[model samples]
Target: MVSKVNSQTKPRSRFRSRNKLSIKEIFMWLIIIVLFVGMLKVTTLLAKTYQENQHPDSEVYGVWQEKDVAPYAAEQLIFTQDGVVFEGGVIDTNFYFDGKYLEYQHGDTLRRFKFLNKDLTEMKMLLSSGYQPVFQMSEKFQNNIR
Candidate 1:
């Protein structure tokens, strides 16, 4: 009868060890999960901030012309709130702006420009030919167009 009792106790102990979790273990797992969630939240917030910084501001809307040129000879850049008009053509979508630069997406093409002034009155178009054409804001659009 003693041997039978020992064998039954051994099986019960093994079952409890295999099936039950200690409080300390549960607490550790909970901490890990919380840390993971916190990390995810931080990552998401960082991503959102980065995305927000990529868009241009309302100050960029204006009529820009090539700097130091005659009025008739100056090339024009007309920027609306949504897009830009260049070379008599309009690109009405896919615009991105960081604090100092603007990016435009054309069909299979990407154009970049760098701002030269704090007021965003001057900018330079970045081109592959090592030609950075300077443009200066000639006219600004108000919130109301009359």
Candidate 2:
């Protein structure tokens, strides 16, 4: 003969009852997920756009130098009919021509120039020591000089 335990005499559980989520919580979660996806898509598009804009094929004309053209330093000038000109202390000087401008840095100085109609339209010269003038000539002007 076992005695039966009464349900009312049993100790109540200490754990709190979890309330069901309301409509507001469900909507908020949906909105959060949507926003997260939207943000991801936007970031991906922006990255693709940035990458696409990074490389372009175009003509560039200018003079550049890897290091300062000291009076005694050996230098070479290279001109291409495609409107690219390279001038530097050494032929191996690391140089690159962007479609619209020429960029060169030596020591703490950075120089940039933009060409228009084969003539320099803008020259940005920043240096800690001396001045270097890079020139651009139109094909007509070059032929006339010759």
Candidate 3:
């Protein structure tokens, strides 16, 4: 006698079927993704900062003295690869130059200086009160005083 298969009974699949992730698993995956993205952003920021610190503007990376200072006086501005150093040993690293002008953030104030000549030897500080103080490269100042 031939046996008949029942309509309600189905054959099992040979391959294991994938089940949907539970709410906890989904939340965990989301957290991991967010953390990974955050890490990548921080890494990119650090790399950019490193590159900027490594290569500063060559034209402005030296000591500059006030144009009208006395021969023996030492009123100067020092620029380094790391930052701009003031007389009192204050260093401000947040600075940028766009060829024509250099601007730096100091505490709550933003200071700017404009290049006055093509040789990049002369620059003037642009103050808000309209008092522009000229500065010359240290070497030029020394030559003039001699």
Candidate 4:
């Protein structure tokens, strides 16, 4: 009976040891995880770069003057031909021209805006502020149009 017990115990110990993780296996798994994370980062950067390269809408590109009840641009609110929008000369990196809505990114704070009206001459945007500022096309822009 004692010999039988010893044999059973020896096999159980051998099974448990086989199940244990080897050092080489652990290192291999860590390397795989690191590579996967790196690939994801690279893919995200490429996607963003591609998006930034796409041209903006002709209607959305220009200087705008701010006004009350305005749906869009002005000297106060502006979109450059590049994928850049700024209020005045202070360029805010948190803006984008999506062809539909001006995607404004205010970090952590959520704000809603609406395009009340838009045309070649004027743009009225319902800003986060209670009053809507109307942006008229710049005089320089008008002169250039002719």
Candidate 5:
């Protein structure tokens, strides 16, 4: 009976044989982290923009002049930050507008105005009675409306 012993030895590399992370793996992880941070920043900016857009009181602050005034209606309106709205240039009308709509009492009817389009420089509104008007921002409206 002849017993055969295996004498094969594994070759050793010149460098250390450790489970080291490759350069490519490190770069990939770094890129992922950077992208995650970038997305977070973008999300924060978008949220701020949305909140600003929803604040009608802030955007509507200051005075607005009617482009084409009717003989029976006021020609100018001034909206202060304290929810006080003053209309003049003929007959004075005092009212206020919430975030969604503007409400006022005219004789027996309660009038409401809804905004259709709005920006820093211009705003368009639709009245409950199907009247639409575009009000340009007054020169006194110097806040950052964006």
Candidate 6:
């Protein structure tokens, strides 16, 4: 007797399928990339705005003493946003003179100076005129003193 076999009853393997991506997964990845790029642009703009507000004005004022004279010469220095003005000069360089009010504009701040003779009486007059006495000396004056 011969045995009979049926080929149509055989089962297929589970790994034999098409490898494809779903539409939903592709859409999710695109959204993530766009959000990252937008965040970077916003951060850059914020940094620029902060830098612009930090600097108020470029002008500055200060006092320096001269080096050549016996007594240092009182110096009133002014620096503009672009450059310097009145490089060097003596305040009340000659004999004791009544203090006079010195006025100038630097950026937004207003600066005033008053020169007085060695005598204390003259210095009082400057004080009454809204000018503050910054320095006092009795000997010869020098440049770059301070």
- Give the TM-scores of the predictions, in the order they appear: 0.59, 0.29, 0.53, 0.54, 0.37, 0.27
Instruction: Report lDDT (CA) for all predictions.
Output: 0.79, 0.46, 0.73, 0.57, 0.56, 0.39
Worst 10 residues of 1 by lDDT: 137-146
Question: At residue 40, what lDDT does model 5 achieve?
Answer: 100
Q: Candidate 3's residue-wise lDDT over 95-124, tens digit each?
A: 787567888877788888999987888899
**Index of the highest-TM-score prediction:** 1
lDDT, residue 59, model 6? 10
lDDT ranking, best first: 1, 3, 4, 5, 2, 6
Per-model tally of clashing residue pairs: 0, 0, 0, 18, 0, 12
Off by over 4 Å in 4: 55-59, 65-75, 81-87, 91-94, 98-101, 104-146
Whole-model alpha-carbon lDDT for candidate 4: 0.57
Model 1: lDDT to the true structure: 0.79
Worst-scoring 10-residue span by lDDT in model 4: 137-146
Model 4, span 74-144: residue lDDT tens: 23555544333454343444465433355554455433344445445555565667776556655433222
Write the residue-wise lDDT of candidate 2 on 26-133 in tens digits: 999999999999999999998756644662222322332323446456333333333323343332244345545655544455555454433343333344557645
How much is the lDDT of residue 110 in candidate 3? Answer: 87
Model 6 stretches with alpha carbons more than 4 Å out:
1-19, 56-146
Name the candidate, 2 or 6, with the larger lDDT value.
2
Give me the runs in candidate 2 sitting further than 4 Å from their true place. Answer: 1-19, 57-146
lDDT for 54 in candidate 5 is 69
Candidate 5 lDDT over 1-146, as tens digits, reads: 12322222222332345457789999999999999999999999997677557664465666665556574673455555434344533222544454556555555655455554544444455555565676655655536232
